[model samples]
Target chain A: MLNRPATDTQVTHLQRLWLYVLCGLVIFFLIVPTLLVIPMSFSDSRYLDFPPESWSLRWYRAYFNSPEWLQATAVSFQVAFLTMLLATATGTLAAYGLHATRARSSRYMTVLLTLPMIIPVILLAVGIFLTFAPVGLNSTIGGLMLAHTILAIPLVMITVTAGMQNFDINQEMVARSMGASRPWAFLTVTLPQIRNSVMSGALLAFIISLDEVVIALLIAGGDKATLTRRMFLALRDEIDPTIAAISTLLIAFSVLMLTLSQILQSRK
Target chain B: MTAADHQPDAPMNERALDRQARAEQRNLMALSLPAFILVGSLVLLPMGWLFWMSIYGADGFTAENYTRLLHPSYKKTLITTFELAFLVTGLCILLGYPLAYLASQLKPRMASLVLLCVLFPFWTSLLVRTYAWLVLLQRRGLINNWLMEWGLIDTPLKLVHNFTGTTIGMVHIMLPFFVLPLYASMKTVDYDLMKAASNLGASPVRAFWQIYVPLTLSGLGAGVILVFVLSLGFYVTPALLGGGRVMMWAMQIERSMAVYADWGAASALGVVLLVMTLGILWAFARLTGAIGATEGK
Candidate 1:
């Protein structure tokens, strides 16, 4: 509208046809595979072939009924929760550090923090396994949390940093001028401003930890198996429809997260 | 120094604030140390150790590990990894660029919805999405079932347990990475620029390639590097979809650890990968900086 052409404003028929075809292709790519999972999950037969002989909820039932699967799911949730808490707190503090100091060290600190994300996860997994070897930290939930925390910290850092760009430095200055301690000035004046960023980063970290399998698989053993690890093992050992069922559930959960994130971002 | 110019009460308060600010800085650093140490110990130290082991040999320091990696068999593996990463990144760009462009063209409400569709799978496990591909590409899988029904083929095509399946799965998993950054960058593109180009007698295609493409280079650079880096590390997708036949470097490292119990070889492989990643990051940074300097000038 700001810079329109001299030509007449009319919809060309060929352009409209092309537009429809493009939109159709986009919709097809996005929707079809997601929809395909539904019937695949319900296949009455043992194999994963489509055009099911009949549809049933047996796989869904199996997913819920299996103790191993349920336990893994519970573990995943717990790990994700802890990861969010740890990553959000540390990440926000680090972001604040960068904001407050404007220190050259903060740049170095950010690299240190985000190194986990930049490195290959498998390599990170191997590193963690070796690092934990001397201390015998293998296969423990605590060790798994630590590994996930490293990976998750970068996410929190990025999100919180983005959020902190809107920080009102003047507010802190004002508080300081009133003889408030810097910590008090920040806690009372600054933390509240970036709360949404903190929350969103926490949520993202949680989802990342929950959905992570490679690290969880490398570090978490036996009783510490995450839902993803369970799914991987299930897929490798058996062609159960239960995996499809679980995948459907996970996809729904992801969609829910995506919606929530959008709603939150829009509100901002 | 500013306190010297302050009023009586102002000087006292300013002094206190200065002390407090210093304390806050100190405290922040103190709090950050634990995170730094934790990551450094776990990631940094082990990475150093991987490099150290890579150079160490039976007779002391030797490049035998690298020499071993140069074997024809391993060369094939390396080529396949690059090929897979290259193809997957290309496909992601192909599939992602238009959707990003289209999304950019949409109303805010519709754009958000389409963006949501793209990001939906991101929250799910990469393993789950790869597993979905397994079901979709297996010999007796959904696609094969549909094709046989349509008489498109009398026999199921060898889709899964091969390169095609691996590429499809990797691209699906990586598409979001390509789209999100491109979309974000494209959204920031000045719409008026495109319109101005068209109004100045340029065709729409010319406007897009000339204005939009060059402007979007940073995001494209980022998106491609991200997709390539991620694809390099991809394990579950190739393993699950490629069915043991697709021996990726990640699988090689896993075998070196689990089956062979050869820490030296595994760490050496890990070192090679780490170096490759760092090299990519360095190159990306240099390229971006040059672009930035050029843009600034």
Candidate 2:
């Protein structure tokens, strides 16, 4: 974007003022709705409002004290953690495999593995529900973990594959030639170089599982319901400001994970 | 170097080398096995069942499941879904293009701030954002209250639980999807061409329209296809905000399964949605590939 002569910088900036203002509104529209609930969550009243006249942690207390909310939160974290591990390991392997194999079949294999992401969740959820029912895994924690891992893998594959573009396979091959095992060469020579993307992909996998709703809505039930599923059910009943408190916490958590990923990505 | 490129030292060594190379290829391919097994069981196997259910009936294989889609109720929902998808995609284009254009033109640090703002809502829970809109656009919600307080209206407007609410929420959700891809493509474009045109006596507007805009069209097309496909299968925002007034395709699919408990109906609807989504993506890929081939020629 190197443009405009040094003498023309001020003129061009001034000329683009209207464009900036328009974009500013678009950015406001993008972010404000999500951020507004942070304050609304602390309201003394039960309903959501902007710039509360009086502030209290009534809703936060409601979220923390409720056993149901706590249980769902615990379930979400456990499932998400397991999903992150499952998805990252498998997806990273698949990405490396795709990069390693010069075979034409790898192209079709890539599409086959990533198909879950493109298909509608409702269909996947229903299919997963039926799939799990026969195995007696429906409504169980393992079922949720497996379903989410599939959804999360495509993202990991995508990010790790993008990261692999900057790397050379010959380095790993050279290490292998120098009396190192294949896994050893990859772990010692390749993984360190691509660790940033792997870490970012892991974080992404964690968040996708944590935030997924449709599958959880269909397949997760009983005491194992996810936080998102619970919040969704709660919202349908009413706009209890308790959910606003929970949303604020979730928004904060997403920000933290994204920041961590950014740090990992930006670091040398 | 590959084993194939190695010098033929001895016949026994050569056979061992070939075997080692084959083993290495197999081992590399083996790495993808876990993902294949996991996804295949849950996603692919279930999809096969969905196709079967769509055709299967109590008596035998039947076409009634798909034929049911011809009902006026289903037809209405199908029409509404396409309309909403188009409306949201158009709104995203109108809003996303300028923001991406501006972001591409800014300093690197400034551009990141703009991108972060775009990505914030995306990272947040889909349900939370839909809830935010549900609160803001509802009767006696903030927007309606503001308009009344400012004397712009005598009463709170019906801003939500309807088509308007769904559109606003969907657009908010889809905007980042449109902008990020557009911004990436725009960043790769050389703006020096536009400056050269300006120097060569073309008007700024003409240069932008003829040169710069054409360069960004591929990005625009990508954003358009992505938003449209996503919107077609969207369920969360519409369900949370539509108040049962709007019956989009995904909502219909959910209703068939959840309300009617009809696997055949749900599977049939899901099959159509999947086909449309995949069909559009396949067509777009070919269209872009064709354009690239012609340009290369």
Candidate 3:
């Protein structure tokens, strides 16, 4: 009402009140579930009591002290870091290839590359687990990285392909016309221009691996447990404040990564 | 040379240039081969192996696992899965349409703020959001606690560990997937069309029905299909929140392997899911030619 021109105020002012109230409730439903956990993390009770009568950081202390939780957290970071590197290297190459090629097969190649994302994660997890079981690769660090890298490839490819849209391919052609090699032209001219999106894709790749739950559940277990795997099992058994603490940390880390990725994409 | 120079009869050494272009395409495609191989061996190869697993039983080649899908229990699971999918998709549309409309009408900066709020849960770990709901809706949990204190009810409602709990959690996860695309489509509508209708002796409600609603129908259809398709294969939310009563399709596959250790049954279930998910996506792509809208989901 305040923002609109004075002449039209009477039209929307009273009539829109119902719309505003309805939307406010829906928006509250959307945002509150995520923020609800933040207060629960500070609870001093054994169970997750909201609007707690007491408060402390003891769950955070519990998480820091437990070897199992710490080990799971470390494994998640290690796998996510490795997945980031591998997916970025291969996926960036694939995106560049898709951008450069004029062949009709390029469309089919795109469909194949993106199939990982379109297929349900449970199906992929089951397949990977079955394939890995016989070779003793299931629950291993390398297997999880391979599984996660497949999922992350489409994300990296999507961002980098979008990034290449603003770039003039003619600039690279000019570099090549001056006797520079294709690889040399790309390294010197194209990489610097699209580095932000590549970096953003890398960040997204990291986040995807860290928060992955289904694949980790089937293929990751025992000492190879990822943070989400442990959290899922823990939640199935109980709802302790320690899990809340870990959840809070995971939420904070993903928010940071997503914000950084968004900033990177928006900049270029 | 311009693009026309590449035409067969218009250019110098046209066939030679065509050959060179084809060679260049292959060379560039070599860059993608490693990623291609990774996805193929990891996804396609295992999926083929699963297909092989499905067709075999203890004796030799057999259709026992596929035949087992005809049993009453399997039918119940399939029916339950589709029913839940319908229910969740319906609720999402009811809640999502209003929220998306509100966001679309806001100023650019304010709309993004609303979008950021919607995406906050999307960015959070799925498990965290499910856990938050579990805590809030459990019998001894916050919602029940508050309800009792307010004297709104004589007893705490059975919110969790049932069908209701699963629906709530699934709707929360699927809401953003519906809203983002619908909002994008909504932004492209010409508000002038509605105003012009009002000026032409139409009431406000008539203008909304005649002009505004038709413009947004395609977005609504897209959102409905995406939500229903996604809900068919839900695993985590239903498994955790439903607490074994729901028996969704994905959980059925998981149970066949985990509880019964029946590779044949599990493999068969996995194959069916893959077929259904891809089939729907392909059919939708063919019908609407908007496969690009499936991005980010």
Candidate 4:
């Protein structure tokens, strides 16, 4: 693309070097903060001091031994599990329906399903808190799961719909025209074809629920607090290395899930 | 075995196939019902409740909550929200554009590896990322310690708990959102166009600005709208890094609810935010002549 091969070699070389250096700095800025926490979490100091004079696993031990932290972890896992199941089921079904029907309203439905993602979480938190309080659903595990499922469904829908785009519905039709029942054809044929999408969607839903905090802060309380909500409170009230330890673990889990999803997508 | 026997069953088979097709369509529509009901009852109903609470007063329906928005402090919060969003969005564009250009120019494999820098932060938890900034930007933080150790200054810089700190943290979070779209669009620009422009005696920089930059405007616009909207509603990063000095709309709604216990006021602020967001999206769609641009996220 550099057509001025004779006259501009020196200047172009300098420009290329400058571009590389600038991008290298930007990449460093993006990833260093996240990477620094792993070391900080292992620091032996009571306060956050980078390049600790000493290193220890004291914060990891604290995270493990504290009942409240363990309980919050458990609540996060439970909510994430339920959200994965609910969102995957509902979202996959909707994707299939929308793909098959090809109705005019499908566009509107897609927009509606995506609203939870587009709208601010704080607004939804306020809305849910007000609506659920009178119905006695606030602070309950069910309430948190419901809110998370709403958030996760759109992601699942998008993934599954993309998967369906590559799927040929005629295969299912042929299976049905033979001897298989509708449900059987879907289970044995369509479901297997889109299994990767469904799995990735479930993983994404799990991650979303695990990381969600704002709604959990406004609605979840007492024994049902999510790990992130607890982390938020901890940061506000005190600076603890235990929070750092948990952050490291959460980061590791997210990296693992994202890598797994990438592998799943690549295999297809 | 005979033509007559086949002829007798042909119409029956065709009718059965028609019935089956209708059933399948109905079944497909039925399959979507569970998700529809869930969204309607949980998401839509609660949003309606929010709107209702905004207008509902102690005695009857009223616009008092919205009129309260005209007050000076509330107006300041709204203006600050937009200003902060624009500042973060502008920084993302300025920083992200070059990085995206760099990536777009590289070989595909190396480009993705560089893009991973952006994606890693995207995949990480917002709270964790924000907390990392908190650790690095606080009064006794890493940056300050390094600066002081180098004898640059005796006192630690007050980086955290203010507008500067909040902007830094937010830009860190929002950088990838801008880069991914911008890079995707940049990759689609034909490099041969630049080559042709240069062959016509245009300098490389002139070719880039005149040809390449114009081609990337769609992606740039999409990225701007996305980062702006997301930053407008940001709650966590500012709350953690702002040290109570920076106030955005999301935090205001939280304060109205938690501190003031004024649902009407909170809901009213929420409605205003929602309207503003939708208005921006609608205006972008009108300007772009497509809704696809607004779906950048």
Candidate 5:
């Protein structure tokens, strides 16, 4: 194709300038609040103030020292870790199974697996709360982990399935033909090829659990309160710099994990 | 003797291969079984229970919970929730499309860096993001303070704890949902087509509107459906920013369950919300499919 002459580029310059301005404003709007929290977390003031007159580590110290905050953080980590393990394992298996089987029922199963992503989260929380209340699963870490796993499974399935699509099944078949068991063949041949997707999916599941709030609000309580649930209540009940400090830490942690996942994904 | 031996063993090799295929099929079924059970019990079963609770009432089976939706107050809340969702989704498209376009036009490496700004918000917790807006938009918050110092207004704007604050917070959270899909679709567009159009003597604007814009309609459709559905179920942003003044359906469900302890009513409201969301998506998909068919022709 011929590169369009200077006339085309020149004529669109004014329009492009306006597009650039709008894009810049949108980027600023999306990023400014997240960027502001870091500075607000470090502010020496008791109240949230911008362009801090002075900075101190007091709020960070407060977050570290507070039993309630610490417990919530611990619970969040525990639930997220369990969610990562369960979702990744089940989702990876489901993806592989679906890819291997050419049955008509697999399409319907794919829809069933992805329904959690489609349904409103509030609805899920309400349903789970009602269902688990009588069974005594409410206010427990296990219940929260179960809920997070349901939410994370679809993500893992989507990611791992994308990886599975690119894999050459002939390699696994060769392994099987060499007298390897089905599981053994998969472990030796297929798993290594799709390890990146599995890792990324696990990272995503961990983040989903860590950031989950609605379900935690409905089910997780007392000693099992997740970090997000605590931050939510603190925001509602009181306005303090401690929430800011915690928010900053959460942001940093997420950024770190996401970057790590990106690196893993790009290695291939 | 060797040829005779090979011929006799062929039948045995075929049976062995058959058994292995059957074993692999069984293994595949077994591998997927746990996920099926997990999703079934935790997700599908609860959803079924929710529907059952919606219809189940004092006298045995009653529509009282659904009838409650007819009340003027409840109707208003439903209308307002949808209206808010529509407004937010519209704003997201307006702001996101240009940014997505700009990102798509950039060099590959530069595009990823620009796209990171969109993805960063997804990493941060929704509560933290909403709280960040609260801190910035409050009466004595950063925006107001900056405005005052610059002598922009006499009084602090009522930015937070209102419709304005709720909309802004939602739009901020939803912009990425719109942009990422829009950018992905745009990247796949053949810029060469635009060149072809210009070469045919069409003006630049004509080429863009007649060629490029039509190509992006599918992305536009996808982004609209995604943002609209997600926004309809939004609870945290509106609750925190609206300060109980603005009530969406999700908050209503919360109140019904937590405050009133009315399981039937809460479940009924949830069913309505779910049905409406699914119905809208189904309609959107049909509409887009028709549009795509016509465009192909």
Candidate 6:
């Protein structure tokens, strides 16, 4: 019923071509940088150069052998994992509570939750810097996770609440009446339905925590430096193909996670 | 008879049980307490600190910070930021709407694929994406290299480190943001209405302009506001692409705070940006409400 042509076939063809071109442009730009990084990573020269005369795994080996890169990446992963856990737990509970409430109150709470996303990270970093300095959170893992969690929580809340909106609350009630406790009902009846949303939210939270730099720079200082912070420092001091190698790895990791999420989303 | 029959003891027991249930509900709602505590401690508290810092001075509370930002150059920087945000938002809408429309017209599987493509770039690092743009748009980078090879020009074009390069990179980052929301809103539009309009002897364009555009305006507005606000706060893209050529307010704030260690001026700049964002958001909410009312009618 929906696919029937409502207009001239010629126009639709033109539209399709135009759409393809636009989408092609997007795809081209999206992948070009990533592809470019491949050649730069293999560059025979010491600097980041395109269309290298010779290709080798020098930079890749360099990255793998360097303890600094390895340690920074591990730190990034640890921070991201902890931030994801904190964000998911807080966000899922908050979303469920807010979603079950009346519309007006929920709307107000939603805006409040979005503040972390809407406010500038620099402003956030400065405030956290001041607040954490007094409490000795500066240059500590706890401080980094705390800052990252604040930003990540809103993302989880938004995604989970979106999933909850379309849910049948009566089913939850039915489960409750069947002698299932509230927590048990939620686990059996609600969690599975919104599992995809939760996973996506968690993925988003992890990515944000991993990619974040400004807060890490401000609070983590030098000791708790993240991979991004390390890269930022590298860029400040020099331009090298090692960054290209790291970028390639990051892109690959993101793609793998995204593919997994896609598989999960499709199951829904 | 009704008052007496409503037996005092029975009603009292019900009231006590009700109070207990209410207490349980309060506990359940307390699930939100952690979020509240976290946000208050990390977010709201920090913002309060920022506000205090903005007003504080070497001596005490003073107008010096705000007044310092009142300089002509600072004013220019603020205006440039607003202007850049406005332009990027506009460009995103212009380009994003058609793609969203076409995407909505696709089969579900294909639509999902298209959406994946849209989101793929978004998942990539912004730092890397900006750097990629630098390669493609650089003087002797890919674009100009190809152009020169094909005899389009003898000399390489000035592409990177300017307004043109900045716009290109900013728009690339922002397109998906605009597209996703617009696509979400467009999915909710009634295809039957458009078909009915066309079936009633209205041309496709006429029906689209008359009905489709109006219905989708809320989505467009939402997307525009999202992009604009995001662009205002953008740091990496402008920093990389502008290459010290274009100076926006965020860059100025960074310089003041990081380079000069001038917290007062930086905080003042931040407050101004915050207030402007809040004001625009208020306006957007009002517009959405107005549109909602019209839609209800």
lDDT of 2 by residue, A139-187 (tens): 8889999999999999999999999999998998899789998889999
Candidate 5 runs further than 4 Å off:
A1-15, B1-23, B289-297
TM-score of each: 0.92, 0.95, 0.93, 0.92, 0.94, 0.92
Q: Which is the leading candidate under TM-score?
A: 2
Residues B1-297, candidate 3, lDDT per residue (tens digit)?
A: 877766766565777898898889999999999999999988999999999999977799999999999999999999999999999999999999988988998888889888988877777889888988988899988889999999998799999989999999999999998998899889899987876886787877787778877788779878888898889988999988998799999999988888898999999999998898889888877766554455325
Return the TM-score for candidate 4, rounded to 2 decimals: 0.92
DockQ of each candidate, alpha-carbon based:
0.48, 0.61, 0.62, 0.56, 0.62, 0.48
| Tens-digit lDDT track of model 4 for A23-69 | 88999999988889999998999876889889999999999999999
Q: Judged by DockQ cut-offs, is candidate 1 incorrect, acceptable, medium or high?
A: acceptable
Badly placed stretches (over 4 Å) of model 4 are: A1-13, B1-23, B290-297
Tell me how far the alpha carbon of residue B138 in candidate 3 is from the true structure, in angstroms, after superposition.
0.8
How much RMSD separates candidate 2 from the native structure? 3.2
* Per-residue lDDT over A84-201 for candidate 3, one digit per residue giving the tens place of the 0 to 100 score: 9999999999999989898889999999999998888889999889888888988899999999999999999998998999999889999999999999999999999999989988
Please write out the lDDT profile of model 6 over residues B1-297, one tens digit for every residue. Answer: 686877877978999998877766665566767877788898888787788888987898899889888799998888878888988888887778877887887889898888987888778877667766776787767788889989999999989788788888899899889999999999999878877887788877788899899889888988999999888877777877887787887788778877898888888888887787778888998988997898799
Docking class of 6: acceptable
lDDT of 1 by residue, A1-268 (tens): 4233322222243544555466557656655666578677887777855767788888999999999999998989888888888888877777777766755677788888899888989999988988888897887777888888888888988988898888878889899899998789878998888878888888899889988888877778888888888788777776777888988888788777777777667656
lDDT of 6 by residue, A1-268 (tens): 3344434321455445656687667666546655687677777777455687788888899999999889888889999999999999898988888877543555666778779888877777777887898899988888888889999989999889888877887798899998998889889999989988898889988999998877886677665788888886675444556888888888888888889778876766
Decide which is better by DockQ, 3 or 6. 3
Report how far off residue B99 is in candidate 3 (Å): 1.8
Clashes of 4: 0
Candidates in order have lDDT scores of 0.81, 0.88, 0.88, 0.88, 0.87, 0.81
**Pairwise DockQ winner, candidates 1 and 6:** 6
Could you give the interface RMSD of each candidate, to one decimal?
2.6, 2.0, 2.2, 2.3, 1.7, 2.4
Superior candidate under TM-score, 1 versus 3: 3
Model 3 residue B261 lDDT score? 89
Residue-level lDDT of model 5, residues B1-297, one tens digit each, is: 788878988999999998877776777866777788878887799888888888987789989889988999898898889899999989998898889877998878988888888989988888889989999999989999999999999899999888899999999989888988899899899888888888899888898789888889889889989999998988889989998788899999988998999888899999998998889888997998898798789
DockQ agreement of candidate 4 with the native complex: 0.56
